[model samples]
Target chain A: MQNPAAPAWTADHFFAGARACIPVAISVAAYGVVWGVLAKQAGLSLLEVMLMSGLVFAGSAQFVALDLWTATPSTLPIGPIILATLIVNLRYLLLTATMRPLVRPGTEKRSAAAMWLLSDENWAMTVGEMAKGRGSIAFLVGGGTTVWCFWMVATVFGRLIGSAIDDPTKYGLDFAFTATFLALLLGMWKGKADLLPWLVAALVAIISAKLIPGSWYILTGGIAGSFAGAIAERRRGYAHQS
Target chain B: MLTSPEALLAIAGMLAVTVAIKASGLLLANRLPQTGFIAAWLRHIPGAVLASLVAPAVVTGGTAEILAAAATALVFVVARNLFAAMATGVIMVFLLRMALGG
Candidate 1:
């Protein structure tokens, strides 16, 4: 019952506008599989993985938590655990803000609710498409739903194959995050002025890691960068693309 | 290691903090002009936010992570293709494992 000839404005638009997301989805699913495999291999119970995936509904944080727990099984990483998850998922705030204008005003609450259901792939698709001024609610449903179901399935599947994912050196999975990030950064860096604040933040984040824990660097660095970027935008009287 | 009670507490706490952080932007987005201080900040948000996410993942990594990241950066810079860079990165890691007998 699929409409094959629809314009690129709907969720189907992503199929036409960008084929890259397909690989992105595969990377995410593979990571999910890695998470699934690691959960059991780390000696944690399956209930832990299922519950974490179901409730936490986060990918990077879950992987980080599993790694921490595996490395040190003596103590629970609940505090740092929660903080890490929060920090990694904090980008969603930005994603939702981008959608505010396009969202139906009457459905603000519903749209906000739907934001929680978002993930990296769909978020990228939504914001990227919207930036081009080709926004639609259908895009959200099509792309968001696709990401959501794929994630749940990927997590469940990842756990099943958790044992086989032990070779960290082999999967090249870490770079998947890196490349996606770089691509995103380049996509955003449309001008010369965007360079300075980012360099400052990178320097600060690395320096902060030396002073604080692994995760605090990200939190502090992000706040510092956002504040720095905001202030710079104010002073320069520069018009932002947002 | 947390029981159901502990897990509930952890999740609830996470939800509370996340909601609090997001609320400020949500509220400000409603109040501010479509193109003003808030909007400008928002405009810069995507690039800045993405930079923050990728920086740590790339440079602050271990041996395997770094090696793979290098390949990713190389591909992204040259190819300028998102999928190709990511795939090359993932493939590099898998190949590294195979070559190293890991």
Candidate 2:
């Protein structure tokens, strides 16, 4: 069912999304800075770095690509890098799919434009808004715009300030993502019914993270937990009928 | 460092794939069912995916990280504010690091 209170596409909705996403944008900015410094160290030019962040726009994938990059084009390991990036980004397939309901009843152009702005941070924020019964494309766009602007600016800034700061991690900026994510997760917690699926997700994620490489844990744990949640939901339905 | 045509080409390729993945669900929206089991399952994805993201990092992190994460969760549960929770975690990590010499 559609949310009756869902706002229409307006400048206000866009700004609301932007305002809501500012906190998460802080973490995104930190990560973007890190990516910029790393990309610089990986021998990317300023133009290239901006282009990558602007075009690719995937943090983990860009990092993975940097890890595989080399000055010699032939030795760049393009195939492996591309593969790893694809794997790391496989979750977007599911993420975008889940967004369909929220973004529906819009034009092909609007839908396509919204899809381009989709990122993990924006998606999480949008979904959280939806869970709160405030689903709106304007919110998504606003949040996505905020994140995009911060990401681009942070990357360029990081590149310019590269090598000046010795360790960003030492400042505990690495925890920014984890902290932001935890907050989002807590925000999304529905009730006791969510405990099992979340626990399953944690268990599977920890295992997959240890056993596998790259970001496979995210996809595996996500899928496994989805199944567990679905099963729990079915059982609850059965109980109600009985 | 300067931009190379080859690198630009590679970046373009990566961009294409990334965009394709991001748009895949929308592109297939018509063909996919939006009800029943699939819908139910999709509903749980955000929580599961987010939990997975945090769990691995916390598990693999040091004592400071664990403690900070705990603090973050506590603040989130109490305040129900994302900014407050994240700020608590970040600040806690810094404090713990300084105090514990990590």
Candidate 3:
């Protein structure tokens, strides 16, 4: 069946996107503040922290980078840090690819801009909206913009208040990351068929996290689970055919 | 902490690579075959990846975290609301930690 004409990209859509993301944005802001505080404690200047957040815009990568950051400039492990960041952000490739169809064909500039703003939260929001048959470039831009702004503000706020807090984990903020990701994972669960792949992914991830160093577990688990899911799907297809 | 120049360079490099990765998907989307095993496999990747990301964290976290994750998952299953699930998890963790005197 032909898809209905997509809604026009307009300010209203953009604002709607922003409005839709407000709740998620609150969580994103919380995470952002954590990143900011951590970045400050990691010996980053306010300028560097802002720059990293503004330019990179990936909370996971930024957190990993800060963890790898060192006070002594000469001792900073740029190679490992960059490699880890790359590994964490590699998931964006798959995410952006999934977004291809939803993203209306437009100027190269617009496409690039949209892609640049494609973080997991906004991507999830956009995909969810599209699934509901209500999505547009404007909505994406608006949502991304809202997240970007909130992230920056939260980061700055965290930096300013970081020294006073001492231990962020004591407040159970450390659980926020896992909680957020778990929430996202729940949203992505399809049905009973997803059970096998998700189980495989969890097992693989735990093993990899324990055995392997760095962030290789993410890639390993993702690939293993995808393969498991594909094989299951293929088998189901055969069963249906027979 | 890297030197000012080194820090700037690292940030710029990270920006470049991230943008490149993000854009590569769109650029290559047209070239990718739209059907068959590859498509089916790609479709499952997001869930797998997210599960992978969440698993280690949930497994490694202490009892409070485990309990919180369970509560969060339960709320998510029941409500299907992201914010509510996350809030449930965070609050659970806080309360659990407080009750346990952790």
DockQ of every predicted complex: 0.34, 0.47, 0.51
Candidate 1: residue A229 Cα off by (Å): 2.6
TM-score (chain A only) for the predictions, listed in order: 0.66, 0.66, 0.73
Best by TM-score: 3
Report the candidate with higher lDDT, 1 versus 3: 3
Off by over 4 Å in 3: A1-24, A38-44, A60-106, A120-136, B1-10
Q: For candidate 3, report its TM-score.
A: 0.78
**TM-score quality measure for candidate 2:** 0.68
Compare candidates 1 and 2 on lDDT and give the better one.
2
Residues A186-235, candidate 2: write the lDDT tens digits: 98888998998899999999999999976668778878988899889888
> Residue A48 deviation, candidate 1, in Å?
3.5
Q: In model 1, which regions exceed 4 Å deviation?
A: A1-27, A34-45, A58-74, A101-106, A123-139, A170-184, A238-242, B1-8, B12-28, B32-67, B77-83, B93-102
Cα deviation of A36, candidate 2, in Å: 4.6
Provide chain B TM-scores across all predictions. Answer: 0.51, 0.68, 0.71
lDDT for each candidate structure = 0.60, 0.78, 0.78
lDDT tens per residue, model 1, B22-69: 443444455545655666655554455456666776666656666777
Candidates in descending DockQ order = 3, 2, 1
Ranking of predictions according to TM-score: 3, 1, 2
lDDT by residue (tens digit), candidate 1, A173-241: 545555556665675566766776677667677777677754566556666666677677777775443
Question: Comparing candidate 1 with candidate 3, which one achieves the higher TM-score?
Answer: 3
